[model samples]
Target: MSRWKPHVAINVRNLEQSVKFYQNLFGVEPVRVRRGYAKFDVELPPLNFALNEHPYSEVGALNHLGLQVSSTEEVLAAKRRLQEAGLATFDDMNTTCCYALQDKIWVTDPNGIRWEVFVVLDQEDDRVPDKQKILVEQPAVACCTACEKHSPLANE
Candidate 1:
């Protein structure tokens, strides 16, 4: 049997800033990192969450939900099991998402929410993405236009 953990992906305006914020909030460092992406695996309550850099005008905070399995075999098994139950499964294999190579299967719920069962590949990618090159996106709505650095939410 394979272990399963909850996976949550959220969109953020700035990846570098958000990563720092989440690190302080969770008191843990992200296990995975790539250009504009970071994955935090928390052991306290057992959660696998990721932050993705995206435009605020694109969508809401939540990107999707999923179960993080141990291996590709488990992912394929989940795919078959899901399909056997008559749910349409979409395969996304050898894809570099959230900064890692992954094999995942997606299924949409009745409410149009998507869920995936995925496994991160052990293959190593040597090309490290330069963090300084990431472009920051602005908030969709006008916010904190005139706030001080330490008083409220502002550049510190």
Candidate 2:
């Protein structure tokens, strides 16, 4: 890839509901609408995101998406916008999440996809919620020595 813009194609259960939720959250109208899809070309950055209606499945609820803000103020502003839209907002102020110093708001869209708007303060060495600790505390492997030998890769 030649370092171009980023685009995300998400599967949604209801196109109308997802479009409305995204429009309210981003404070913008959909740039394009199709039979089973809606596209929002947010002008602030190079994010080209779209949602399409598809058959729902429990195995694939979230296909991964995130928003990285420039500053903490932006994070708070996003939270306020989400709250004003009457969306569910989960805030963890000055908390470490995904191994980064972040303040963010969490909301699930109509398709059960988690959306995260976050401003990162700093980087850390571990995933927040500490999965490794849980794994170590309750070792499910047959050999603890082999388990310790398998070093996990870092999240890209």
| Count of backbone clashes, every candidate in sequence | 0, 0
Tell me the lDDT of model 2 at 9.
Answer: 86
lDDT per model, in order?
A: 0.63, 0.69
Candidate 2 positional error at 106, Å: 0.6
Q: Model 2: per-residue lDDT, tens digit, 82-152?
A: 88988877765675555456677676676556667778777643555655433222234332122112212
Candidate 2 — which residues are off by over 4 angstroms? 1-3, 59-63, 124-156
1-156 in candidate 1: lDDT tens per residue?
177877777777778866765564444889998998999998844889898887655334334556678889988887777666566677877665655567887765432335677787744444546553342333453422111121212222
Candidate 2 accuracy as TM-score: 0.72
Q: Can you give the lDDT of residue 147 in candidate 1?
A: 17
How close to the true structure is residue 47 of candidate 2, measured as C-alpha lDDT?
72
User: Which residue pairs clash in candidate 1?
Assistant: none
Winning model by lDDT: 2
Q: Name the regions of candidate 1 deviating beyond 4 angstroms.
A: 1-60, 123-156
TM-scores, in order shown?
0.43, 0.72
Name the lDDT of candidate 2: 0.69
